[model samples]
Target: MSLPRNLCHGTLDEIVERGGLTEVTGADGGPYLELVSSAFPGGQAPVGEARVFTGDSIAKVVYVGLAVPQIGLDSHMVFAFCPADVAVPHFTLDSVQGQGTYAFHLDLIPRADLGTHLPYLDWAHTPLDATYEEVESRPGLMKTAIGPRQFAMMSPWMLVHRAEDEAFRGISDAVKAYLDHWFSLVEAGVPAEVVADVADTDLAARDARNRTNVFSPDVDKVWAQVERLIGHEQTEAVRGLLLDNCPPEVSA
Candidate 1:
């Protein structure tokens, strides 16, 4: 299998602008953000977008348009919020979903395939939210509020404008598809491959996710679990690499 790849902000920005926004709106009917459209459009080409806060905890979104030279287009980004503590009354953990964002960052995935992302956030994941999906009824670009999440998992608006080449789009699409399918599978209680396909270039990024990405953390702990997992290989010299990079305590 081809080694896992880490995508950059620059590549995604070009393609999305080329693909253009299919639709935009606020999912599940809230005033926090908006969704753009491309899912099932009137035209043969497909597109889609939705924007919301990064999570319920904060109002400001992370920086966007990283792919683009100037910044994102004149639109606010959508964020997949996971609230550790549930909000009160109005949106309950069970009733209305006041806690988590109930979101998934779909990189290389196509707009039409959004349905594929749903399973991971379904009833079983409940307070896990993945609930309250809404979008704009028209055409426009969109973005996600990412907090050191998988580079592919996010759909930053600027990335839409930046990913101009076919290769970049192909890669971006591939990553997005992987994330959607992977996240959905995990939500379904299936085994998840949240491990990173690492390299020297992305060493810092990989470490960042291990540090803050909600889904996964700590290379040694994660690797220990993987080692305990059924019949795995120690390719890429990861064990040695971790020893060289991590603190002695973590390495031990």
Candidate 2:
């Protein structure tokens, strides 16, 4: 299996094991399964698949993958968001293999603004500093060209880069370290001092806006590529699921 697939499925399994989450049914009142398109306009088979689960501390765990192996485009993404009541950072990963190049973005999306929340920043992200620096300094892991606005939505510790095969394979340890640290935070909960007087409603509102902006096409151009393969409607449908907002298509 490719690294992206392995890491995606593996981390998903771990999340389910710990969270005991149940998949949320679609309007069909059945399991959520989607076949986005049989093939792209160019005749290559394209798959835009999603599975969403929710329960316990996790409000939603969204897994979406798009693949057109004929063109060497395979992107697997996962976002495990905690309920609004808690200030724990959400887990996220986007691993991609495009036209002989390997790239991945990994981070724990912040629920509180790291710049102002010193305790939260130190508790949630500072531990990963060494690992982040190590991976950033790796010889073949060159930084991806991300806009400043998109970077603001994620943490400073996010690992996003294009890598040579060796560097790509070498990232496993760093990925493990990040995941393990996150699992610990989930189990231990954020220090009370970190959340402090922040209201749960405020956290919920900020998270809603953050989720929407993080995936907005204005900040992230990758949605354009997805729209090209899956069409605008299906692309928005997927976005709707990620945002935990309304479905794009629904009856009154």
Candidate 3:
């Protein structure tokens, strides 16, 4: 399938322009990024390997790749981790398009109770209200496709949908708006001393949430194919790099 060009890379470039980022290498001995995957036929290598970006207020890792025409796989992921003590939400965006359909999930995942935090919720969600309203008004567009297990990790502002061309542009616009909002929150994040006191608790909670939501049963489906292409050891390494979030060998 012919997908949108530079959609994910271009967005990341905008974020990079907002602040300086230090590059981190991956286990593959290359830049901690993969431009494309060579594991499958016609995979076209990912836009690049997974890249990690860190700044004062936030740290992010992103991966963008075209579909494996052989198995119908195409997707991009962005996972941004904020200072633990900041009390702000973490950002998660996953976009998958293939087989004549698309699934997009974007959220400012709450670290604690969203219901009790009206001010933060309002600040985070109000910007996308119009976009949400438009999406909800459409038929068969808005969805709860994240599955029940991952629902608790999402905020009320979460956008999960099966988008069509009519709704795609609006969704994309909302993504950009949300990204800007998240960057602002990162810039105005809590002090480092506060983060130091709560770093352990915060990171533990984030890791637990990621283990539940980011590492899904569905991932095994993809891994089945990956193992066949790359073999067991390489597949395990890739899975660890992509889904584990905080590997034990590395300090958080």
The parts of candidate 3 lying over 4 Å away from their true place are: 1-5, 26-30, 33-48, 64-66, 138-144, 190-213, 216-239, 242-252
Best by lDDT: 2
What TM-score quantifies how close candidate 1 is to the native fold? 0.21
lDDT of 2 by residue, 18-107 (tens): 889877666676436464664446453437577778776777888888777767888888888887668888898888889989998999
- lDDT (Cα, 0-100) at 118 in candidate 1: 40
Of candidate 1, the 10-residue stretch with the lowest lDDT total is: 88-97
How do these models rank on lDDT, best leading? 2, 3, 1
Show how many residue pairs clash in every candidate, following the order shown: 46, 0, 15
Of the candidates numbered 1 and 2, which has the greater TM-score value?
Answer: 2
Candidate 3: tens digits of C-alpha lDDT, residues 1-252? 233324455566666667565556566555554444456556544433455666545544544344455566566666666554455567767676667677777778766554654555565556668766766687647584545545665676788787776565456676787788877766776445534444445555665655455555453255575556445665555555544434213222
Q: Model 2, which residues run further than 4 Å from truth? A: 25-31, 38-46, 197-201, 245-252
Candidates in order, TM-scores: namely 0.21, 0.89, 0.71
Candidate 1 lDDT over 1-252, as tens digits, reads 111112422223322333232222234443222222222234222111222122222211211110111212121122222122211101100000012111113322111112334432232223322211211111232333434434433222113222213322343343343334333432343323211111112333433343243223242233443233211342112232221122111211
Candidate 2 residue 175 Cα shift, in angstroms, is 1.3
